[model samples]
Target: MDESLRAFLEALDYDGEPFGMFYTDQEPPSGFAPKPGPALSMELEQSGAINWQEVWGSFSCVIGSIWLARKKNTAAYFEAARYGCMGGSFYLGFHQPQLDFITHYVSTGIPGTQVHGERYLRSPETVRRFFTEIAPRPAPKRFCVFKPLSQFAPGETPETVTFFGRAEVLSGLVFLASFVTDDFEAVMSPFGAGCSYLTSWPLHYLGQGRLKAVLGGFDPSERKFLKTDEMTFTVPYEMYGRFLERWPDSYLRTDTWQGVRKKIARSRDAWGEQAGQGDGKD
Candidate 1:
């Protein structure tokens, strides 16, 4: 294993039997006896049964990518693919329940079966065309900047801000923005906040530097509404990686969230204070 991969695996706190296999059915593999205890809810869960093959396929892809990276000495591409896997795993886990419901219940019902049957009955050419038409194109280089609607006085247009960063970071941001914007907005709206980033600014990656983007929503001020913003600031790449390591999951802690908020607040307040001093001198 390459040093990086070895280091990553070593850092994980795994306590399970080495290469031990656990089965929900049948006896454990030869030489291993089943642990005598009631099966946990997770062990009994059948939600993933239908998609077990897909799960294996994803696992193989991740492992194969790492092996290929080691063989080809292409660590950069491997790291990117690893990051992609993190996002892909989160997406699968999030949607697995709905898929299980559809497969077990919906597919058994008349209306659902008819719809699914019709879809399955389509010609290969038609199916191919359908997917081809709907597949997303490569993400473009773009992002947007946003502030509160209240930040601007009545009749004044909001100013647009933009920044350029590393290509990988920019692409990641664009892909995530497109993927999560709708669902994010839906979830955030009930709390009186709207997404305020995408369509307002562009994200640029800053390479292996001390630059990072903090994805969090601005807390509701007097208006009782939160606004999503991608706040960029300087932080070591290792620190940034630690944050991304938890991507699409428990990535941000309350402390990091509050820290970003304070950073932005400080920047804004400093700018306002400087402007006030200039006005006084005039």
Candidate 2:
């Protein structure tokens, strides 16, 4: 992380430093990799019910692993062969045209059967259309790593920077994301998993060379992994750099932000977070 950027966010009383997403061949240190899981496709094909235990061992959501990444200040990565879930494999760019069962799984399951649906959407067709519209891409490398920005090595560049924060912190970031751009849609909230908002959608904008920020963490299924007040904001890494450079000239330094800062302090108190706490409470 740039020292100046760190100072700026600290001044804003942002809870933690933003983390970065990048691709590398290197595996994460032992114990940081997600618990080994069975192939989702095979499990669904054979049992009609997911063995959540074998699928993720101790944690189910990929976002939980990400929270661990931020909390421990270490890298956690996903590979094509070992990505934790079907949704993760798709959103993290390991696969496309995700498992065939996804269409039914997200909506209504097979009629009169034990394959109950999550019912996230009205119908299979709607879920199919959602996937078609988002159009996830394949990853550029074998390993997709999420590391705290401060831990990035020399010459390492992240594809995107993601922040997990409450509404107040996100408000400042949202404005900064748009402060330097004139585009009407500088920030977007799309429908998808928490993991998708953190990586896939931001990568989608990066691929288009657009400096859009993604607001996510609305996925009910993954909410259990996050703090009660947390949501996510992700921008292309280049755009994050622009935020760092322009924030000094933006509204962050003004008295108005000071009011927000007070609110941040109050929130920290309510959440039992202390000032100068390590990174954040995630």
Candidate 3:
């Protein structure tokens, strides 16, 4: 098997169990972009009853090029080709039900799948540059960028924003944006008011979310409402992994982002106060 396939298996933790690797590119190898279906599914031959309570994760690996893989989770693998086969297997990707914490994945295959994820998320522009310059195999010459950078809340440093620390902070926010009925208080608590930084703008087609966009927009019908004029980017997962490599203990909470989150809360508080004062007779 090709190392990409082997490394991909290792990254997925595939234990030689009877499972198939489902693949569908986001864009065509040609000039046309890939119109990813809302869901990518497959049927497995009879193998008992597919376990419905296993883990389903969309992870990116960091091996060769950046890659995205969504592991089909089933405590029990389906039945043989057909024993008493009579069933329907189809569900919305978002509605499929999750067995563990939902984590973001890489759109491109990564070099090291065992530990890291796809490479695209690591350093968006630089990674893209790498693909253009150091790509082992030939690929179409199309590219994407994060919307917030090009436009929206303009007037800042050209290269790096002075405020934001890690781009994945926004990367995490991008993942949260996918939720329709998101709990702002709960979601914002982890990353802070940084949501305001990203939420106000729209998503570009670059970052890691490109592969399984099976769900389309986070809000489904939201494209009609262009909140901001930003390009949706496939997640630069390689950028994300590079971040983790640099900051090994990434799980620790950040006081800086916490402070930023608090400031947003304060701004909201101030806005409420101003609104109340405006209503009173002057």
Task: Indicate which candidate wins on TM-score.
Answer: 2
Please give the lDDT score at residue 197 for candidate 2.
Answer: 92
lDDT against the true structure, each candidate: 0.25, 0.79, 0.23
- Give the alpha carbon lDDT tens digit for every residue of 207-261 in model 3: 3233111111232122222212211222223322232233323221356545544
TM-score between model 3 and native: 0.19
TM-score of each: 0.16, 0.89, 0.19
> Where does candidate 3 have its weakest 10-residue lDDT segment?
61-70
Best by lDDT: 2
Runs in model 1 with CA error above 4 Å?
1-50, 61-64, 74-210, 213-282
Which lDDT tens digits does candidate 2 get at residues 115-203?
79899999989998988778777788889888888888888889888888888988998888888675668999988988999888877
Q: Mark the regions of model 2 whose C-alpha exceeds 4 Å error after superposition.
A: 38-59, 278-282
Candidate 1 residue lDDT tens string, 41-61 = 222345433333333343322
- Ranked by TM-score from best down, the candidates are 2, 3, 1
Better of 2 and 3 by TM-score: 2
